[model samples]
Target: MSSERPKLPIEAVELYNEFIHGGMSRRAFMTRVQGLAVAGLGATAVIEALMPNYALGQQISKTDDRIKTSYETIPSPKGNGTIKGYFVRPVSADSRSEKPSKLPGILVVHENRGLNPHIEDIARRVALSNFMAFAPDGLTSQGGFPGDDYKGGLLFNKIDKAKMMEDMQAAAEWLKARPDCTGKIGVTGFCYGGSVSNNLAARMGADLAAAVPFYGGVPPDAEIPKIKAAVLVHHGELDKNAAASYPAYDKALTAAGVAHEGYIYPNAVHGFNCDATPERYNKAAADLAWGRTIDWFNKYTRA
Candidate 1:
């Protein structure tokens, strides 16, 4: 968890990213790697090396008093049962009862690794911006996000995909109906979460006022027509698998006459906005994307 971390060669990092992201199979990457073999590690070692330890990836501490936090069991009507989530609202939002001060709600969806510290911190950041941020643990029934990223990934793999969407829908509705909220909602997701945000926009229709999907896959062309929200997208050009659909999604949104903007950030790869993974973090791009996301939310949800 220390700042003094092990450094991996660029090639090794690339291969690990490819395998971790399903771009390549474990066997395929093991066969192509020339470095891990020299270190006397097999495929297992390569996987261990890429696993994230949550303690080291802190951008915002959990104890930060600027925001009020709650661990809640929200209704998950489409899931097997209720799902737990980490919710945050500005401390000011909590203390104020004025009608004009009612904040908009933002659903922060987690990636395949479930609701880890990074996503929790993201929710806090959104709270600091004065929105109610509810980040659900999609793997809640599977015991939520394991402290280690790899374990969470394993848990996520066993989940019911359809139920996950249902739970997400429930979370959105719960936030919209909250006492402190203004009934306007925006959703943002990263990686797998981003893909859901894209699909959720269409699924939520007029309920979702805005969506910001970062480095996520695009929804089907047919789904694009159902999206009533304004969308702001960010992706890393180097993440070819996710980037390949950019054009198709662009054309679909344009054809559907949706108000949207998409960007493929130069020199950034998938998860660039996730500062937790230093290997993929791109500060300039992350800053730009965050700004655009905030502006997008303001235009559609707040303003």
Candidate 2:
């Protein structure tokens, strides 16, 4: 966690997490915050501070000359029919070249709130790392993210989980088949996206080379043996729900002979990798997990 900003109470942060995760209504969340107000911080201030700051979390600018970006809509016959996404790639992978070198493709999945600015920025970061990245909006059928996480969460819940999986599968297949992408592909995601990463590994089989899920849920034991991708799981130590899943997940992977690794960062909480929410972002954990993610992708996807 960054010390530059005022630290928020852990209880309040936990309540906010629960609210965003659909454990409570917005009105209830607000009422609860009012009770947790401390010196120099009112309910309003706490709520505002807990909300994501997209600008501050953006590590790569959309206009940065190093990367090329575009919006693409791909057919998802099994899903909502069509899905839109933010696509990014290194400038060197531009199609204009006589024959651009094909690069590994990365499917960047966002949290429960659709493809928000922070996730778009993550795609840009992946592009700068020498891989082509695509991040699809799960709420595409609902008019996308709506530019507000609270509303986005509501919209996300309305989406059919099975259809959303198909939509992500479509995005991954589309990226893998692109002229500028190598046949190998990897997936990485945060929170809700993290679970998608894990599930995609099991579903895509040979089509997926690697999967890095940050604080995501574990797939069922029966699905474990189907995973062909090398898996890297990241969990925050204090994120009880996700942390508790790690041991069982790790054991299942080992029993299934799946290549995998799991790490629980000390003192971190759920959503620790999301810098957009300063109240919960753990810089040290996020940085370490990110570095390991890149290495895992390079090792598995680039091979």
Candidate 3:
């Protein structure tokens, strides 16, 4: 699909970074980028390259008979109002029980995009793996997910970071304490969600058994010692900032005596694990990273 999207030059990448960091307005960026196309650099191709193809986002379908699903609203004691999310767990085809077999729990955090269909799909995939998965919508206080075209930055800006963290902590603990859970909880996230995973893992410490952060930022070196969960970090070699942070994070993790593993997929860029963006997705890298993530969770979060 991205056959026409040429590899971007350093200049274009810098402009994108500036835009994401809020240093440039969208209008200014677009106007400048149009000049790139005029200059024969394929600017529109660059934007299309970053567009998410929701059709290819999820690995599993919601209607699969192998999984039981529900929408739940749970109270967040963290003063972030109520939390709402999609919950799923695998079921035996032959069993008619309302309650499925007890399994480990996983918190599937979404990208900066709130809890969209992709995340719901991810929850199902986790359930297929025989774990109970719950994906809380951080936009819960703002009425939850805001339909298909919701801009994440809008809801994100309205949220208080501390409140969001507290709410997630509540969600994790709630999932763990469920009668259907084995009490072990794990977390895995991509991009913004990945950064949250790292932050949550450090904050929750031993309470969170495992964390897999896909192309996410690491905590400050000084904060590394606070993390107790066994971590597996997947990074894209072409994501300069993320790639640069790996060695320092690895060193800090080692020094802090944390159990961890890290991988940098060659030639991949940020969001490489997300199959929705054809231009950025690296199937081989995504598959390898996903396998490692599931294996890491199985090893560390098993009952």
Candidate order (TM-score): 2, 3, 1
List model 3 lDDT by residue over 1-303, tens digit each.
Answer: 555535655456556545554566678977776666433346667765555667778678778889889998889987497888899988784335775567889999887658888778878888888889999988888777776433665676688878987878788888989998888999998877788788888888888899999888887667789999999999988888888998989999999999999999998877777677665678999989988988998999993
Q: Please, what are the lDDT tens digits per residue for candidate 1 over residues 195-287?
A: 989989999999999999998888877789999999988899877878888888988999988899999999887788877776677789999
Candidate 2 lDDT at 137 equals 98
The segments of candidate 3 whose C-alpha lies over 4 angstroms from its true place after superposition are 1-23, 38-46, 93-95, 148-150
CA shift of 58, model 1, Å: 2.2
* Candidate 3 clashing pairs, residues 3+ apart or interchain: none
Clashing pairs in 1: none
lDDT of 2 by residue, 2-116 (tens): 5454578889889988999999999999999999857677789899999999999989998998888999999999999999999998886455579988999999999999999
Instruction: State in Å the error of residue 80, model 3.
Output: 0.9
Residue 140 lDDT (model 1): 90
Report residue 90 deviation for candidate 3 (angstroms): 1.1
Write the candidate numbers in order of decreasing lDDT: 2, 1, 3
Candidate RMSDs in Å, in order, are 3.8, 2.0, 2.9
Most TM-score-accurate candidate: 2
Top of the candidates by lDDT: 2
